[model samples]
Target: MSMDAVTLPDLSGRTAIVTGANSGLGVETTRMLAGMGARVVMAVRDVDKGREAADAVRGETEVRWLDLADLASVRAFAKEWKGDLHLLINNAGVMAIPESRTKDGFETQFGTNHLGHFALTNLLLEHVTGRVVTVSSSLHRRAPGIEFDNVDLVGRYTPYRAYNQSKLANLLFTLELQRRLADAGSPVLAVAAHPGYAATNLQSHSGSRVQRALLAVGNRVFAQNATAGALPTIYAATQDVPGAAYAGPKNMGGQRGAPALAGRSEAAWNSVAAHRLWALSEELTGVTFPLTSSTG
Candidate 1:
């Protein structure tokens, strides 16, 4: 697919929440959504930074505090939400940082990237009238499968390995969320997208200095700008795509270009694991699918 092929409709009356909306892909996604006349809530860990970013975004926009690594913050944000949400963009995430755990004692990567959005989505599901678009990555393919027995990766921890597991969890979350929504006969869609080597600050935080240095060079030389990187997300958000559809760049083996329906690893297609993950998420977060009886 080409950039020209994916056009957005007038989103004047719609409302969207883009997490990590202070910078990079999140901010770009917020800009595009607001430019199209949607009311965008810029959810971030830092309220001040979010305000600064929101100031640059033209059209209807607001900044709200949300620390995805902390479930308390996620619950607070969801509780304050009053109206229907047209687009819930799970765009906030951490990259390959050193081994750490969330305030809730979960692996930081999985906690913020997958579990946080998992809780927020379920908490806000009743109010979501349109779609849920989670930002994933091509790195998800690196995961063998979720370390169900040792989710935190414990003694076997590695930065990239944990990152991969979290990313894979993102896709599996989408898969199960869509299945539950379908079982409930809801119109809302669940989809995932990857920025595909976007030149974003996300790479700057890699645990290895050597990796970070190399990624910095790659970002300048090969990666697409944030605008192009945010396309797959924008495409997944507004397009009439199917549930669980994965979108990413269509060129250079998904490293760059326009958004298209991208393929997933065999593990990403594992429905059983998807369900198991969903159950585990609920156990960890104390949040269940809103349409519980129907989903079961």
Candidate 2:
């Protein structure tokens, strides 16, 4: 369907949690979902910034503090969450940045963009019934695949490479989540989306000055605005699609255009990798999802 032709379904009784809701595409996705009658929880690191963004939306929404870089914060938020959750948008992430580690000593990009969301999803699995949307990126194709030995990328750390690895992890998570859910006979859907080249502050953290400058200029010339970028995510969360579907703009080289079904990497469909990632994720986070070998 065309971008303008798409319409959100009614969500009067739905409750949604959107990470990174304080700005950019996350903010717009929360705004549109709330506008459609869903009660949104703005999961952000900055309460003040989240409040400001929430206040701008027309419908009711709450702000909750969550730091994806800190596992403690993630646990607290998950423990505090009550009632059935219709959606969980893993929209919070960091882009290219200088080598660093999370509070738990994981590589920064992999920690914040992959492990954090992995932990959060496991924590909230019981409460989630409808859909889980993971915000990945086209850059996922850049990485070779998961580095089983050096998942932390301790010795070999390049900003872009790490970022790509994290995005690939997102796809692995989505596909594995769907597989597990299907095995369990659960109704919850797991989907992924990329915003294409949207103008957002995510690039502000880039380690390369040249890359940052180019991003800034490209945002003005080539990138679409945040609202347009968020359409794929919104569609993934609300659409009546089957589990494991991926959404993105139908543009040249997947750059920019109307939102539609996008193809994932061949490796993303590997069930072995998916299962391996799931086991490693559980081990790393110390949070095991209630998954059986055969969910169905």
Candidate 3:
């Protein structure tokens, strides 16, 4: 399928929040959603960059501050949100950067990519009228499972391992969240997508210069552009996909192609791990599933 192959329903009157919407896949996703007539809030850490990106977008868009690495920032963003949210795209993330901790003293990659979104989603769950779409990566296959005993990877931390673990956590988070939503009989869905080696700035932050150089070359030679990469996410957000569905490129071993329903590793499907990870995430982030049963 081409990028245009996925026919999005008219999104007029709907509202969406796309974290990291200032650049790359987030910008492309925001453009597609807004262009389709949804009112999109570009939730970015850098408001100036967000404004610059939103200026080029052809539909309704607002730039708001959201730093997913900081729980405080996440809380502020979610607390300020008002009215119904048709989509919440957990799109912001860090790659294989130097081993660091977030403002709240958690592993940077897991903190920003998983726990931050965990807290934000729970904080905003009451206002979400539709679904939550999380962006994971095919690299998640490399991770065996969440490091529940030491999620930060502390002494065992390699940039690649940390990134892979965080991405895997994304899939598991979706799995558990969807189960909770179902158990609560909520209509909102939880799904995941991957960009499949899209050429984005995300790779430039790798702690290893050698890896960065190689990825730069790969981005030019083997990766798709951001627009193509955003397709799976757009599809996951709009289409009537099943809860816990994962979408990615359909060709080249999921490296690059049009979006399609994609498979995940066996570890990603382990409900035991998923549930345990959910418990740990709640303990770490101090956020819990907000709905006991659907209010509607």
Cα-based TM-score, every candidate: 0.97, 0.97, 0.97
Q: Which is the leading candidate under lDDT?
A: 1
Tens digit per residue, CA lDDT, model 2, 1-296: 23478767888999999999999999999988998899999999999999999889999899999999999999999999899999999999999999999999999999999999999998998999889999999999887789978998888989988999999999999999998888787888999999999999999988788998999999999999999899999889877777999899888777788788898887777778888988998998898876555523
Give the residue spans of candidate 2 off by over 4 A: 1-3, 291-296
How would you order the candidates by lDDT, starting with the best?
1, 3, 2
Q: Which of the two, 1 or 2, has more TM-score? A: 1
> Cα lDDT of all candidates, in order?
0.94, 0.91, 0.92
Candidates 1 and 3 compared: the better one by lDDT is 1
Q: Which runs in model 3 stand beyond 4 Å of their true positions?
A: 294-296
User: Where is model 1 poorest over a 10-residue stretch in terms of lDDT?
Assistant: 1-10
